[model samples]
Target: MFCFSCCMPQDNVNQEPSTKPYQDTKPLASIANLSLKTDSTRQRYVAEEIEKLGKNNISADIFTFHDLSVATNNFDADNLVGEGGFGRVYKGRINIQGKDEDVAVKQLDRNGFQGNREFLVEVMMLSLLHHQNLVNLVGYCSEGDQRILVYEYMINGSLEDHLLNTSPEKKGLTWDVRMKIAHGAARGLEYLHETASPPVIYRDFKSSNILLDANFNPKLSDFGLAKIGPVGERPHVSTRVMGTYGYCAPEYASTGQLTTKSDVYSFGVVFLEMITGRRVIDNARPSQEHNLIEWAQPLFKDKKKFHTMADPLLEGNYPEKSLYQALAIAAMCLQEDAASRPLISDVVTALEFLSPQPGDP
Candidate 1:
């Protein structure tokens, strides 16, 4: 299928062949050229790295196996950034043919559960997605048992870091920043659902998967759980249910009927995380509140308790109207029935209407 994530077909750039020497431009339309290469260990590393980086930059700084190894000091743990189901992330810098550049490398565990298919899935989907609020995939490496994906580093790290209340100095994401993130991330999903060919379902859209650039802008990441919808006229696909426990759509979990609304449900769970500074699925909660979706339902319905849901770290400085609008959008997304959920397009429209402008942001 033609790539639909980046731009409308009407915007396709048709440049005449240049007689001059090569000049750097945006990446070539090469989606048709990509395919999965074999190598379990390397694929594992790539998956782990991309998630930790939050997004990869497909248009720049791709590295070869040799180039990546030297930059990462042979995958030293001292440079480690974070860990996840896929692998550990380490900071790396490669001076490709003497041009100094910084990058992050993921090292996958040999015994890890994630595999090559996920690595290829991310590379394929991310290669086609471009947006200011989404991380870019710079380059990737795969050879034998070593697999690595390089990405544009999000200096501030995941939104989860800033929102956690347990940290004494949690920079506490501001209401404006939180709303901007919500709006940007919603646009990213909207593009995926409405713009991309065969509409990709992110399947995983949680706080930790949202990374922050230096300016605190949020970018969606982690496409391992992403699904490119079936070809023409097929409404949905079936698969073994997989996703963070709290974020999966109830209808999807029950029926295995995957649709765009599945992602809408997941996005709603993340919306709650952004507002409340709570994990989508937390084992630490009291048994009665163990299920985050059920526990948080009432608070979203009542404006008084909306303050309760607001990150106390904010100290209740947010605009009530805007907060309610976001809550209203989230409530619609978290509907128990898939048919009741609003489209990502509608979510994008609501967020656009409610998003804070420059001075306010």
Candidate 2:
């Protein structure tokens, strides 16, 4: 249910303001510095686009600011689940279809990296794209300068919460759980790359963006950075480099020539993280191991060293055959040459075999 991505730089994480909720629906002062002309233009654009979408009949509900305020108990501190450069996500409850249900309310910061355009883009993207592995958008609140998104509350929080920062009392994800997560996440990417109209390029694929339900089912979240894949004869979508630091593909980082393979490379990094239980970029580790891909590139070349790359926390619990096979999939995705990387569909097919069968246990 959380919207704050843990993949951001530590310094960029803003402390939530302790101010009381506003009694009226007025724009926040944070956006005051923006020229009225600029703000008007932006709002006009979003309004026009929304009008167009209304003509086509989008399914997402348009929630009022007052309704969401009451839902989140005036954005109570206790309900805050996650926060990042984008904004804070709060756990709330609202009546849907006449029954009360839990939801995650993501309130975007007026001065944050996510602007009006990103907010509209997210609302549009989630409204159009539906998949089991994609987080469900219940509605959004775009009153004044306030930009908020309401989504189906995932009880388990983000995968990063369990995988990279699990508390001492909590157990790490088991081998079976990891494979299941990888397979489900891969299917989500496969759907985006293969099934969606015009195909979607999940430009910001990373571990922190993957949320988990009570059963540990993974759902991809935060589509603000998502873009339409190249159409027709075009092979790549040219855009400014804008993904998380460690997860961006080398070619895209340098050239800004984005393609579906860029997302595959990012997926490779996340898969490697899940397998090894290490941050993609950890300065605490030795200089040689600071960069996960660099450290694993050599090991990927030698099947004999694959065991060494496994998460120490796994304690040799994974099957030797599965570990090698999983590493092979990761290796192919991490290929420096984008053309060499397996299509997301192919990756999904490879991971499908790694999941345990019904009678295996």
lDDT of each prediction vs. the true structure?
0.68, 0.81
Clash pairs (backbone) in predicted model 1: 42-146, 42-147, 45-108, 56-136, 56-137, 57-136, 57-137, 57-138, 58-137, 58-138
Q: Model 1, range 1-361, lDDT digits (tens) per residue?
A: 1111211223333212112222222222221122343343444545454443334434444566787778888888788888888777778887655777666676555553354545556666666666666677677765555556677778888877777534674467778888878877887787777666656788888878888888777788777678766558787878779887778888788988899989998898888888777776677988867776788787765667766777777888888866666677777788887888778776766665555756653
Q: How many Å off is the CA of 358 in candidate 2?
A: 4.8
How does each model score on TM-score? 0.80, 0.88
Give one digit per residue, the lDDT tens place, for model 2 in 12-116: 322121222212211112123233436547766566666666566667778889999899999999999999778899999999889999999999887743467
Candidate 2, position 109, lDDT: 83
